[model samples]
Target: MTNDPLKAAWQTANIPAHDDLQAVVRARGGHPVMSRIRRQLLLEGGCYILFLLVYYDFFDGHRRPLYLNIILVLSVACMLMQHLNGYLLASSALKGPDIFRSLQQKVLQLKQYAWLSVGSRVLGWCGIMVFFCTGITWTNAKYGLLAGAIIIMGVQMAMLWQLWQRRINRIKNTLAELNG
Candidate 1:
């Protein structure tokens, strides 16, 4: 095997050295999806924090029912927690004694978080909708508009599900290849 030209060629392939790879990783993060997740975490977390800061006065949260206010805040809290978990998972994707073990751990964690993430998003959306629509008398136009928003969020949920599927499958395939 050592003397075979094909084996030699494969063994000596021009993979980037560890430091160079690390530098690239530092520049762009591990995977594009992971980077996207991290970016989303920051963006969503920022927006949620902004809403928390301004909701009382700007959104008339002060005049809102105490239960509604609590529900809204709790929903936002769930969303923030979801984002934080995703960010942390993305950051730790490559951190382990070895790549295989690291990815294995990630897949496990991902499986565990899948429902939690989806549930949080759904809860947050429903909570926000409830909080916003509480005082509004629903006309045909209002119902139509709310229906449209609900449809949009439904599509978003499907897309998010697909993204999770892709991310998890890709990592699993990578792990399988490494095992061989």
Candidate 2:
């Protein structure tokens, strides 16, 4: 791996079409599997970040609503698990044997993460619904909605930025391989 930390990280984490496209391509036959894995990882990471934002915005301070707190806590846990699973998939995809095997493992891990993500989201959505239906003051409800929206956008942007960084590193690796 190159001395560049970002490049090295990308090389180890399997972000396709980055600096080391040639080696990555040669190693994996330019298979679509790598791209698919990358996309899935990005999506999962984005979702987790969004969930975190929602937790922070509304639940960070003040007396916690019992039902809302429980649901938020569970959602945060699930999101954390999903984030870890994504990182694992990225590392395994880069270093693991065959692309098929790597993908299989990624898919299995993703399945679990997906369930968690869905559950967490559901809990959050339901909590919001209940809060509104229970006739909570508009001020509280508005804050929750605002927080949720901010988190959604923030998480998406963060995930995309991470993906962009990986792509740049991959590009650098490709350049090095070509010149060498």
> lDDT of model 1 at residue 41?
78
Error of 2 at 112 (Å): 3.4
Error of 2 at 125 (Å): 3.2
RMSD for each model, in Å, please?
3.6, 13.9
- Give the runs in model 1 whose Cα sits over 4 Å from its true position: 1-39, 93-101
Query: TM-score of predicted model 2?
Result: 0.34
Error of 2 at 105 (Å): 3.3
The model with the greatest TM-score is 1
Candidate 2: regions farther than 4 A off: 1-65, 94-99, 128-180
Counted clashes in each candidate structure: 0, 10
Question: How many pairs in model 2 have backbone atoms within 3 A of each other, for residues 3 or more apart or on separate chains, i.e. clashes?
Answer: 10
Writing each residue's lDDT as its tens digit, candidate 1 over 88-178 gives 7667636689989988888888987887788899999999999999999889999999999999999999888888888899999999999
